[model samples]
Target: MFVFWLVQLISKAIYLYTVLLVIYALLSWFPGGYQSSFGRFLAKICEPYLGLFDHLNLSFGPVNFNIAFAIIVLQLASQALVLILNRIAFMF
Candidate 1:
């Protein structure tokens, strides 16, 4: 029971973080948006995770493809974690 709740909490946190990442990516499109304090904070929180995909250098002529890929990956990971937690809870 406790484990289930804990997993739920963690899952929610991850989902929220993913949303923040999305916001960060969107803000990047505006000039000087990333220079704001809030933007910097978002970057600090999101960069490490997004940085993973950055290594792939997934880009076209101008678009940074990795940002989309990273967001998708984060969503998939959050879903998978929740699914696994539910499965474990069911087994117990």
Candidate 2:
């Protein structure tokens, strides 16, 4: 039961991260920039994770590479969620 709760918590965290990543990507499409209310909202949600790649000098030649990296990380999280569910099923 404790293991089940742990997996549930992890799944929620992963889902939140994935939602934030999607919001950030959508915000990137606006030409007005991240200063807008919606942009700021997304920035507030995404910055901590996105900031990690900011210092790396990573780029896709003017495109925001950070979003791509975040999506990849989220993808990994998704795979992890599937694996965890599979384990829980097997355990029962």
Candidate 3:
């Protein structure tokens, strides 16, 4: 039961972070999006994670893939974690 709860919580967190990353990326579209308080708040949480993949030059011409890639990786990790947690839960 506890394991199920933990898995659900973690999965939600991962999904939320992915959404935040998308919002943060979209902020770049506005004239002063990143300069806003909300943008700053998002930067506090999203920048470091995005930084991990920044060097990959995920941009192609005008389209940037950094956020997309980060989200993909995060989702994959989340799925992997849930699988591991479910397996461990089954053992008990």
Task: Report the poorest 10 consecutive residues by lDDT, candidate 3.
Answer: 11-20
| Stronger candidate by lDDT (2 vs 3) | 3
Q: For candidate 2, list the clashing residue pairs, or say none.
A: none
Ranking of predictions according to TM-score: 3, 1, 2
Cα-based TM-score, every candidate: 0.87, 0.67, 0.97
Model 3 quality (TM-score):
0.97
Give the best candidate by TM-score: 3
Query: Which residue pairs clash in candidate 3?
Result: none
Predicted candidate 2 versus true structure: per-residue lDDT over 1-92, tens digit per residue: 77667777777887787887787787667787677987888778788877877876657688767678767877796777868776977788
Instruction: Please name the candidate that would achieve the greatest lDDT relative to the true structure.
Output: 3
Q: Which ten residues in a row have the lowest lDDT in candidate 1?
A: 2-11
Put down candidate 3 lDDT per residue, 1-92, tens digits, no spaces.
Answer: 99999999999999899889999999999999999999999999999999999999988999999889999999999999999999999999
Residue 54 alpha-carbon offset, candidate 1, angstroms: 1.1
